[model samples]
Target chain A: MLKAIQNLGSSTTTTTRTTTGFVASFYRLKPPHATTTSAFVSISSSLLSYYSPRTRPTKPLLFLTRKTLSLEPVRAHSTRSESKMDDTSSSSSVAVQSSGSVRKINFCQWCGGQTKHDIPDGEEKMRAICTVCGKITYQNPKMVVGCLIEHDNKVLLCKRNIQPSFGLWTLPAGYLEIGESAAEGAIRETWEEAHAEVEVVSPFAHLDIPLIGQTYIIFLAKLRKPHFSPGPESLECQLFSLDDIPFDSLAFSSMAVTLKLYIEDVKAGSRKFHYGTINKRPGTSPSDTHGYTLVNHLQS
Target chain B: MLKAIQNLGSSTTTTTRTTTGFVASFYRLKPPHATTTSAFVSISSSLLSYYSPRTRPTKPLLFLTRKTLSLEPVRAHSTRSESKMDDTSSSSSVAVQSSGSVRKINFCQWCGGQTKHDIPDGEEKMRAICTVCGKITYQNPKMVVGCLIEHDNKVLLCKRNIQPSFGLWTLPAGYLEIGESAAEGAIRETWEEAHAEVEVVSPFAHLDIPLIGQTYIIFLAKLRKPHFSPGPESLECQLFSLDDIPFDSLAFSSMAVTLKLYIEDVKAGSRKFHYGTINKRPGTSPSDTHGYTLVNHLQS
Candidate 1:
């Protein structure tokens, strides 16, 4: 069901690794239609503009170009059964039951009665409605909360001990609980995953991954003390300087984007809170697959 | 099933009218345990501090105090059948199926099969599990998006044509769509409810009413032009200056608090975006019932 094609270049070639555990060759595909511009091409164009020859060296620039373009294919399958499999391969902590399996809500939880999938009155979409109780069940996006803890120019990271990216590094984050603020949830998750105590400064990023039906609210926090250890959910916990970040082994795309933004903002001497949405678009190639747009930019 | 107990004052008794058409007398009851603090008392205390005498005059203060406190009983019944009735009295546009009845989901919607009301595997809450297809049905909080549109020193207000608060004025807002950003949802709802085109300035308020399972995200916006008419959901649409706002006939509690905060900020000569949460607490008196807390205050 999965295949990797390598396009080798003379003297210098860039390879990117995906969650599928295969390295794919980096190549830009021309737009199939003349009038339509693909998101992949736009991203690449922007990346080329962002990493100009006057600003940075060539080696790291090539690495970043490959890394950003690699997100397309994984995001393309985000709404399909293949996407579920990709998610499982990347992070077993998600709530997907199985890959390539049909999900159907056949029973009503309120009365132990049969249900029918149909559109309810005054609603735009189809829902699981109970035949006996006349109650319509709604499924909303789940919220994931995490913190970007900065202590003496180092950011805290945790290595997963569980499936879905076993041994892969990630920021301390998890599903939000009921009856708690987003900031509170982020703080709690940080403590639970990395055993770190940190005070949240403000909301840093709000990314909506609609394909997976999850919204991530990340907060910028200050470490209370330099003390830290791995919690039950983590294999190891440690702080790393900006230069030592494992960009390739990161568990999620949102984390990578956030870290990159933070680094860029710090380098520019203007660090601010950012809120944006990440959406995956249908495209012909991996490079043209995903679109990340910043809707609101606020400085704190 | 309905009773109203009035504690008449000697000569000047205050009577409050509920959306249910009941004119209940306003009276304060001490907590059952004097030493123990209920959410209601805490809210009242905080409200007293928030509405200190130094900020404004005490004439309209009584009405503000009464309005904030009136949320207690409705919130108290939010988890019960009576709460549904209260909601029907206030706004009929909500997604609740029935009023004054126990809601149950008896049948499964996915496969038209029987369902069991039980906790699914690896979950903390009980859900409607499917009998045949084995899908767990999950219900989550709905997102309510709206805009606080300001133009020429006036804010837009819409009179609701639907039930639950028929004829009561409200800010243009509605349930958010699955695949749209919160700001986009707010803008769409504004157009749908008031026939107005607005450019969103920033997120102004985020109120979580877990009692009714809703999180409201209200944005501060500016009207593109002075063009507006009543939409299908609205009976009338008009702009109201700060002095002309109808606090007594507003549809929801959060709207009242947002307006109040806006006024207070304007008065303090610091007109900036505010992000906060409003929580309703169980109170003894209807006028001392709910609390609003500013968890994170940032000036932008």
Candidate 2:
């Protein structure tokens, strides 16, 4: 998709790195540094020119319009369902289930389903307590960053020092800082976790994993310097070839999908771009690593 | 631009309504829809495939990257000294100024410099609190929406419902809702303000009047149905011919820009999409009009 967009007669280019792959080409685009950027202004104005003739005073043309692109009613995805909570006027009720049990049980962890549990310990309980609002406030996920860095045809990998995956190898990624754009956050994470100066490439992968309460956007990037030392939060940071990727040691199932996608891009050659999971059929793997999961090969 | 994009081929039509002058007749391809959208996806993808095979896979394509897009810098019209407020943390200070004969000056609205008289009342102070983080918030200009609706070779427009031009003519446009997509909101505004069921023909106009705290995107739309009844908000909604556009009664200077753009698009026989101000040039109109406020163009 990056290649296709680039080939649209646009003079725009990435300034971050000099990678040839479309995914790796984002590094060449100049960073937004000054409050007023001359280069950005010029490109934007030129791109606008591409649309200028259309708005010029002349004969009007017939246009096609639709309420919906497709007649098919979209089935609700888990992420869509989760986002709905944010849209409601106020937080709404959500039934909590422990594990996979279907029993109707809503007792507080601090205090079981008893009247005493509702009483405050020292200060009087606030009369304006809304349980639904409380639940939503407690469960909102922070924005997280994920990246794939390349060096000498090998991809960089790191083992997270935190739990959920204390030892499994993963991409050099982390949460975003306040007031920073996603791309900037991704680069900052690459630096902090991998201790490497890397150029961010095109945004190639987006995965919304509702089960784990996370939305991961995996970017393809190029390492400015291949030599990187692991930061304190990383158990280790190292490069691995496609064949040598530690599939068994992968942390989240999403990482497997990310890797599988990178492999497909490698195989599809230059024109390989969008791998949108928007229309993935139901019952399919949320990660969509159908034939590529390590467990699948291990089981066979 | 859209016609050029649509009729990339088709040698038969030379300078027809659908023909963008610069496009190649050989590239014309019929769209699956009544209007051709073939170039939007397929042609671009095919173009990406034409990249030179020998091009290094690791080198960045400058045009495709953001760094190379040249956008203009914001020119400062004010002669005030360049001073930045360093208050990301928690300190507050007061600054006073004496203007000529007036010794008791007020607050500096642009820099958050407060004056003794600027001290806030409890409720007014509360109003300034940021809802997102519960802190005093800086003022920001609100966003507005605008639209161009076409019917019977004429375009639909509305008279201003508010000041600075209490009753000037302009396209039916307004502010965007919190979470609305730019295009979606533009369409919705047309329906609400004009009582017209219209299809968005092509996006071709924009205006960003930061001095007055406004940013707007104007779209050209095909009137889906001529039968429309003015909604409660609109004083009147009607069509105006190209030759009969009420130039003197046009709402804001930006509205004049949209009208001029629409006229140019008709002459150019295509859509001209743009960002920032509708006219690309700086100060195209000296002493531009500020208040032709078109409000609530789109509902969430």
Candidate 3:
């Protein structure tokens, strides 16, 4: 595992196996030009001590590989995972603070021109307008696709290896990529997170978590085979009966509500589908007791 | 109606009543400093003639207000409406061309700093990275919410007064706002376009049009009263029996399929809810016969 971390570095500086049998891989931080020398040194020292062998045993090992690092900055897993591993929560705090500001463009990617923020003629909202190339940039909500996989009277749950809910169980889901249908995205996320093939039955839940700027489209799917294992983003993948579900440790409130709805419907013997919205109050942790409110319930 | 158009201009520059008695209001083009002279002249000439009274009779009267301009650049409605009113299609063509390019930020909206476009350290895709503020900007899909309103054995339809499918019939719908539930957005749109309140019964159809980067959530709804008329975004609102339904003139393929499903289910005495996706092939008009394919179906 230490060798894997060494490979992640562009050029490895040192590698050592500690007395505790944990590998310590150290690489020089390639700070961007804008990073101050003092800031770089401070960040590096903190990172080093955080990854030292003494601190390794208690932390989840999911972030030790490059595959897990492929998740984007906007994802809940990325924010949560990094905050836990790093002793300082400054980075995660910065991300959270920036979420409130409008997404502004500083330089044009096409012409490298300075941009202005204004509502273009005939447009309603303010947009980033290129000062040189006259290009207009817009921001929209992202689609997060996942599945509620059911098999043999049990639902599949993966113990997340990354943050925002590291070590907590969740349905297999991730950000939808460009050029894919919602169903395809959901199936892909399931396979990527759980190493399981699924046959999507139907669209089960449409949740708009506007606070995170994501609209999660969850499908009710069936496991194609009984075999399953944890993928890079998951520490463990297992089938949990209703009685065994860990509601307290669910990764997201949306997942908890979805699972609860599914369980209750199953008990009633009338498994109707649901579509609605989930809103998390500002400044409240998603896992907070009063954090999220389900505003609408549409059942069929 | 002509008087309404005159009121739209900040300062009345030129207003002409044509032989058809339609008022053509032309405002001076206030191009941004970055816009090239030739581009401004070309865009203005086309826009002027498009809104001219001679061309007004054939088009839907949707673009007669500032509220409609609040629609974003990502929507098919914006592209279609602009092209129809502009006459030359050059503006629409320019928008289509820009769609393929990355959304660039030239000046950071937060700190007025330079920005770069590159795949961020841990992400799979390229994004705008602010140099001064260290902000990462991301683009995502937009949600379009609407309703399938039924009353007294008749389905309500609105003749769109806006562009894209101007003059064509459609269920009342619009872009989902920043802080609203999908059901709230759908109900609001129905009221805004048809002057009728509706109780959203359940989720009816979930269609993902990856080509336009939209996820449309349609609901089964009930009209609160027998009274409705054309709202600002609609030219005519009426209830059509199954035999009188206008399939060929429906505004969107997803709407057509949803209506068809509703009709078929009603005839079978099983108004089961449907969940599925609709994918449109690239470069094909949405109205094209082979443009859209429904991938999966889940009924209850």
Q: Using lDDT as the measure, which candidate wins?
A: 3
Residue A282 displacement in candidate 3 (angstroms): 5.9
TM-score of chain A of each: 0.64, 0.48, 0.67
Q: In candidate 2, what are the lDDT values of residues A1-300, reduced to their tens digit?
A: 012111111112222211211111001112222112333222111112112232223212222211110111223322211221111111112111100011112221111221111212221111111233221001112234567886777899987765445566778775432222344446666766787766554444534332222335455667665568787667899899988998767765557667766775677663122221111122232223221111101000
**Ranked by TM-score, top first:** 3, 1, 2
- List where candidate 3 sits over 4 angstroms from the true fold: A1-137, A210-212, A281-283, A289-291, B1-118, B126-134
For all candidates in order, the CA lDDT equals: 0.49, 0.37, 0.53
- Model 1, A147-244: lDDT tens digits are 89888899999987655556778788876544344655577677767877676665566555543455666777777657888976688998899999
DockQ of the two-chain complex in candidate 1: 0.12
TM-score of chain B, candidate 3? 0.66
Model 3 residue A48 distance off true place after TM-score fit, in angstroms: 42
Q: Write the per-residue lDDT of candidate 3 for residues A34-67, one digit (tens) a residue.
A: 2223321212221221122433332222112111
Better of 1 and 2 by lDDT: 1
* DockQ of every predicted complex: 0.12, 0.02, 0.12
Kindly provide the TM-score of model 1 when superposed on the true structure, using C-alpha atoms.
Answer: 0.62
TM-score of chain B of each: 0.63, 0.49, 0.66
True-structure lDDT of candidate 3: 0.53
